[model samples]
Target: MLYPNGWFAVCLSSSLKPGRLRTVAFMGNELLVYRTRSGRVRVIEPHCPHLGAHFGYGGKVDGENLVCPFHGLVFGPNGVCIGAGRSRTPPRAKLDEWLVQERAGAVLVWRHNKGKAPDWEVPDSNMAGFSAAQEACFELKGYSYYGPENTADATHFMQVHHLTDVAMSHEIRQHQMEVNLTASWFGWQIKVRMINYGVGCAYAESELPAWGLFMKSYSFGTPIAPLKWTYTLLDSTHVRWLDALPRVLRWPPQALVGALMHWLTVKEIRKDFRIWNHRRHVNDPKLMQGEMHIAAFRRWMMQFYLRD
Candidate 1:
């Protein structure tokens, strides 16, 4: 699913001070992202053509350009040549620049074929809201699609965790059914049933937008995808979920069922996380068999994934 003209990458967080360079990869290419002395962000290929040295490891920010440690070659934000150690260098040889921007408190670099960027904004403001909250991360050893699939799969709530309060069924025949999902500024909001279903039964949704922060990619290239999600619970406290769901469950204790249910739900989610460490993949072609949201997810993915 990695496409040169159809992929985007999160380069780094906005907290990084100026003159700092970090290396990140997306769609099979390495990106060198750095903050200028004045706090501006720039994205470029990590390699210096002069000697093929990776600037990520030892690159320094020089004024508004990045200076290569090996040859004092400087490249501007647009990947244009600004300076070189050699007195007179050919202007035709310039560093390659990727479309980069700061949104939602993170640096994002575009990698597609210079195509127009996706419609979603970088979400700079939303990111700042969570700056003070604690942060954590985890790895799922499964295909990247598994993460998205888990979010949209509602039936698993009961079978996997043994908790049944939410029932979700897509009206498959109605392709034009209007689906309205509104989130507050902090990425948490209660679903108001203005269009379909009934009140009080709607679900609460919270997570980073899938295209921006929600996109997951493993750094180790082990196919172990990583997904980041957050939630604000009833106590006005925030919780960030970085683990995966489990594969099996122990169903019993029907009398103390309430307590048992809570215990098993937590345990099951942890188990799913552990199981994810062994599985990989997101979209299942077999979703046509019984899953309904899978279709909507597929269509949603195509809309942004293939957006021009």
Candidate 2:
């Protein structure tokens, strides 16, 4: 499968520390990921431009430059070699840098097979008052399309999550899509809104006003290998009572509620993991009524994974 041209996450932002270097597997290849002493995140091909030495093997960061172990070549944040070991003038060498952004507590790398610049940006999703992200990642034997398609699937809620009276609406434009769903889960009214920034990342918010419960979730579909990928979900919960508690006494309750929410959300999401991994695409199947959005979603995704 062709990796879609979009901003895909490689790792969580909190996982990388300043002046630290490491390797990450993305789009079926290993890429070097590091943070500078000044707290800048950079992603580049692991191999050094000189002698094809792997940066992840013995690379170190000095201030804002990456020092290669093979030749002691120092590369600036822009990936240009400025100093060479035991030499006055550095040889002509440069490391190719990948476009990267840190947002919503994740490190995202932009990919365009045709070498085009990123025309769209990932929306900042950090919540100021919400609890810290509770994250989990799982391997999927599927393409990135499944995540967005699943968001547009309305009938599945009744069958899978045991919801009733489900209705969905969509607003799509260019590289963004929003889906709103209203339903009843065992007599409690609930509403969910999903905003997808392309097909790789999506934000979901749920409201249960009657129950005084709300939740926020962000999911990233990252390609790793042919017919193989990873699905990561970051969830946070906002309990109404937690807000009323004193600042000094809120941490424990907030942490407890957030953990419970994360567990429930993960358990519910696991129900779809089996279907996503084992399911096959139906190019032209006769979809049931109220499934037009699924077809539209399939059409909307074509722009991201076009044929060369």
Candidate 3:
């Protein structure tokens, strides 16, 4: 199948500074991500149209445009060549520009196999009073779809996480999927809500309201090569005492609580890695009654796969 179409988080917004260019590899393509002098981010095809010089290497930012190192040609944010070395800009000198947006502390780009515009937008984490407190980045030897779709696997909670009394409810809407899970974890009642936007990005919030503890996390999966994917996990926590108490009194407890949650979240991902690494894709399988959502998820994912 062709690459799924949607918004993909390429890198953290803080990683790219003004007048800096970086190369990112995703979906079997190399992209040049740069921030202009005016603090605007742009994602474009890496090669310059003038002489096919790669813009990711030795590229200079001239105000709000990118200067190719080969002949000092300048290309504007719209990917149109604006100037050349003492020469008029050619009518056909242009590079392809991808749609980019900065949201939720990350740089996101819209990707479509057929070169179509984005049909939906990713939700901003700040709007929900959430911030990334911990982040983990690593490569996984599996397809990109496995990570986000795992949320809908209801039976995996008891088998993988050792949670009891697991109950899951799923709500599917246009361009989004929400899964709510209520379970018992090591004697604590846990409620987890996961929202997936497209196939590559998802956000989850887990709360233990009785203890005044809450955690919000975002997960992104991007394909770098054939059967090789990169997964980024960002976790944030909100504790009532941390906000209500004085800074001096809150420092110790806040750090300890946040560290504990981060550790457990990392451990869970490690367990998932073991399974996803060796699992094979089965087009047709005899599934039990409880596995109905898995089928529905596959059907929903078909919309993103555009065939030529």
Per-candidate clashes, comma-separated: 19, 0, 0
Candidate numbers, best lDDT first, in rank order: 2, 3, 1
- Worst lDDT window (10 residues) for model 3? 124-133
Deviation in Å, model 2, residue 82 alpha carbon: 1.2
Better of 1 and 2 by TM-score: 2
Q: What is the alpha-carbon lDDT of model 3 when measured against the actual structure?
A: 0.83
Q: For residues 1-308, what per-residue lDDT tens digits would candidate 3 score against the true structure?
A: 46788888788787899998999988887988989998999998899877889988888898898898888888887778878876855446888888999766678899887778887998876524333367777888868889877898888888998999988888889889888999998888999999988987899989987888888888888887778788887787777756777767776776678778888999988999999989877777577888877777877877777553
User: Residue 79 error for model 1, in Å?
Assistant: 2.4
Residue runs of model 3 more than 4 Å from their true location after superposition? 86-92, 127-132, 247-256
TM-score ranking from best candidate downward? 2, 3, 1
Q: Choose the strongest candidate by TM-score.
A: 2
**TM-score per candidate, in order?**
0.60, 0.96, 0.92
Residue 112 of model 3 has an lDDT of 83
CA RMSD (A), model 3:
2.1
Clashes of 1: 19
- Superior by TM-score: candidate 1 or candidate 3: 3
Off by over 4 Å in 2: none
- The numbered model that scores best in lDDT is 2
